[model samples]
Target chain A: MTVELLDRKLLFVTGKGGVGKTTIAASLALLAAQQGRRTLVGEVDAKGNLADFFEVGPTAFKEREVSRNLWAMSMSTEDSLKEYLSLQLKIPLVARLGPLARTFDFVANAAPGVKEILTIGKFVWEVREHHYDLVVVDASATGHIIGQLAAPQSIQELVQVGLVRDQTDWMLDILGDPTRTGAVIVAAPEEMPVNETLELVTRLRDETVVDLAAVVANRVLPELFTRREEKIFERLPAAALAQAIGGPVQPLLDGAQLAVTLRRTRGVHLARLRRELPPEVPLLYVPYLFQRSHGARATHQVAEHLQEELT
Target chain B: MAAKKNPAANTRSIEQLVAAKEIVIHCGSGGVGKTTTAAAVAAMAAVHHGGKVLVLTVDPARRLANALGLEAFGNSETQVPPAAFVKAGVEPRGELWVAMLDTKQSWDDLVTRHAPDRKTRESILANPLYQNITGRFVQSHDYIAMERLHEIHAAGTYDLIVVDTPPTRNAIDFLEAPERMADFFSSRLLRWLTVPSRSRVFSLASRPFYSVADRVLGSKFLEDIAEFFLLFQSMYDGFVERATAVNRTLEDKRTTFVVVSTLEAAPVHEAEFFIAALEQRGLHLGAVVLNKVLPSSFLEKGTTASARAMVSGAESLAGAVPASVGSPELVARVLREVGESFLNFQVVAKREADTRADLSTVPEVVATVPYFDRDITDLAGLLELGEQLWR
Candidate 1:
């Protein structure tokens, strides 16, 4: 496989929950690291499955080496907030203590843009921190990734002074540039996720004005059946075969029918997605890996699959 | 007790229901306009009712920010645009505040506040295990958010606080914040484990090997426990005190839980769960806001003409149309099927409504905001949402 998109410095992978987003992210990071680029994979969601994937204990804001040339960290909003307060406010223990800290936490958690701002702020910092050559964020699914990315802009307007505002402004500039920051949407070839992917792209284009680099249609079925199999099924003796197969065959037939139905439905959604997506944006199809895509082995498989499109 | 029928019997406007409280919780599933409704209520309280209002949301998605005509909101209470309120014709009598929940920061603040000393704070923060455990505990975030809400209320900055709880995935965690706080405090396991090796328990080890084991495992264990307790101690005390006060406040009808939902089965089911959970805890179920409701009028007027026009137009334009024949009818039928499914969901919602006598009413089904055919990336979209929700 030709690795076309592999040289990119940043890869932002996101999809609906439970759609193997983490697996794909881990693989991409692994691929980058394996190719000898200093790589770091980050997750903003509360579920820190990356540590488990790397066979390490849970990680925090501090980057821990997971593999050669690859490091991992789970962004903690509280830790980031504390770091921000200490570094920005320069108020030692008091920054975290007293009414002001509580008020800050409350406001941060209660506001729509604050959490995203903090999470993305951390990413922007990592990008500029010069710790690694590439940074990959396992962003929340399509529904929220746009908002999360745009959070810095929302927050930059409120705080005019200091590093927070400066970082926000800088991050916005980086994110606004297509070459600097790339968003790759991961989706299963299903109606909801595809529709959501399309909607998300349209929104990102409209709202953030950032172009999406690619659409990764994950868990696509391989064309397993051919014309011969179709003909065989069609030519089977109707009554005798039905009787020979009996009740067990009924469920198998039902299962086959369901599979066909699902495949056809998925095909239609995929078609719609292709029709909606701008032609320039590369659409990468990753076939369904039958086994659970956990740990290094599964991730490597995904990496191999992603190698051509990524490069 | 009036002889005449109650206009509000079948349906009540959200304005009447939210008129009384300083806080209204819009709780529901994703895509149900819970965020939009929460913003509108906060806007209503600030502009119409003449009260300083704050809308707190935990939706990681900035949909709420988009709906409020704000470029973005942060962990601090940012003021809503005056233009938004004026455009909505909502007379601004008091300031409008908006914030999103950052549970981690709140949790950390709780820890730092309660730590016995600066040394203890440093030790707890430094420990890796403490960091891992605290991060994994989802309720910790909710407890901190609740604490923040109490602080906001105590500060008297805003008269009303409209909170949009995290989506239904962890609705229980948000509601059970107090209980979780109490549990964290009362649990002695961490305290027992963290006690220093110099203490009586580790002194029992006499041999050099045992002493080494004691030094390594015992100190590590104690540090872990100490770190855990140290981080949580202040939060525990504060949470208990605040929870007691807040529980009483809620029980006395000072706080209101507005259960927001859609006329859809899953959302309605989630609303029912919220109601049951609230009632079980003795908290008042203030109001139910059924959002994104397809107005019954749209269903009755079938698009027969539109369907026919599309079919004829498709035939005239192309020799062979793609996919199955009657594609327009199929699409319409699918939409109608979705509508029927929603109607069935309303049946379930109505059933739940009947079972509960405590403040159950349906607001007119707000139409689904058209996807704008464009991405909602800025404040304009949020303001557009504000208009739809308020109306």
Candidate 2:
């Protein structure tokens, strides 16, 4: 049986930038924590905005509990490398390794997959050690996510024999399994985002071992009118309606018209996404919350909506 | 402050900026329509100014790519057909060209140009790590894009070149990539990492690092990377000279940056950050193109009262409608829905307005483009977008 999304040990949530990838990842972890699972959510890019979702203070590499059964941290490759050295390699002297860690980003930049491997390795280690029931990663955007998720396999091919090579086997076993780990792609129901989502799905299948757990269509606008009502909406006399309403009604009507046009335009892409995504991949939707604020409150709303979709 | 210095310069539009500058780079956080804005501006330049215009975009939507005749990826520039302009009901005074940045191909070209010998060039191209770096690493995209832009600009083919920067992890990464590239070649760490491969001499200072690296990555992998870097060092002088030239081009007086963003919170925040970065670097801040802005009508006087009236009085309002429209019950439902929808959108529009107001230290020309109802698939749609920024 396929494990439910929340039940997975490791979940890397990624999507195109600006598609609410962080929002979805935050809410998924929030929901899992509320469901009584010990959850850890790591923001991979460290934009420091993930803390805003919970209205908490800024996060560091060290995990902090934001609420009951929930923790948050920001991934730093240097810190991840330090942790890997001490925990896995039994390197106790961080001071001696300090200079090496300082230049880690440069090495990673030159070595291609080194940084990606370190990032993924930390999360996989968390799952392997059973530190958290669920580790939801606000992973890299779609452009770089495949490289990150496939880092272990790439490293395996590059390194003939090493401790890193030995470690890749377990990381692959955990990541490649559908039950323990999966990827959630959060997409907005728009043309470019939908196209990117479809492209990423193919890339994930071809490039990474991670299974697609879910596709979250975020900020989906509501359907404004039924067929009969739409015809009625079109036929309404604008001038006459304003006179009857006792206020300028053009903007009001125009607003609805705009919404309808938006929904219609977006619906085409949504349909394409649904039709093209694999049949087994569950697609969940979170509506456009036309609120004035984003933060802890908005995250709660998103989590509630996700809960509804999941159930 | 600069705008204040030249009072008449307040009216300097994107058109004037493009005409005056050799390079106009459209940059912001991802998915804020940078590619479309750059393309639109280039199209506008071709139509009005009548010279060779090129838009070197990083990533564009598929249909927009098709519209521009960029059906495949490469560094090659293709002219957007004059027929497309005629179809869009515009006759260009000059020509519009398009190119998509293919990172791997551009890196190969860079290697070909900088390598001291054919064998070195061939070896660099064949290196497995080199292939992976060119293909997968994000920073490589930033460096190669700037490198490609410098090459094209130096060729002096286009009257105006509009560039869309890659969506970097940090928006400032690309801006600093050239300098960073130069620094990497001269850094001590590169020497340290490459030491073992050079003479098998492990100095005391580097011994601990080597020991740790060897244990984790194995000696063979280290040797492979050391060999790669040793090979890379052969062309260090040419690479550093090219990187320095790229940096100079970015700071050139003829270059300008157009910051594009929606009035959404995150994108607006990024725009603010980017504008500050540009100012800090002493680069020219030409204009700010605010894309996908909501209609000002949403925040107009007394729209809320009208919406509330519709919601509270839907049934009574429905009764006033003619029988030809719909049944009273359905009419009431539609009325309520419309009102609620308007109210919902008003909340967002108000928020957007506040965010727009929060944009501090904005450039002289801040052009706001209303959200297009449909994606810009053809030249007509692009021209429509361009018109908003032209004035």
- Measured over all alpha carbons after superposition, the RMSD of each candidate to the real structure, in angstroms, is 16.2, 1.6
Per model, how many backbone clashes are there? Answer: 26, 0
lDDT of 2 by residue, B321-352 (tens): 89888999999899999899999999999988
lDDT of 2 by residue, A83-158 (tens): 8888877757567765764467555766668889889999999999999999999999888888899998888878
User: Which stretches in model 2 have alpha-carbon errors above 4 Å?
Assistant: B1-5, B60-63, B196-202
The 0-to-1 C-alpha lDDT of every candidate, in the order given, reads: 0.60, 0.87
Which interface RMSD does candidate 2 score? 1.7
Scanning candidate 2 chain B in windows of ten residues, the lowest lDDT window is B197-206
Encode model 1's per-residue lDDT on B37-68: one tens digit a residue.
Answer: 67766765676677678998876555566556
Q: Is the docking of candidate 1 incorrect, acceptable, medium or high quality?
A: incorrect
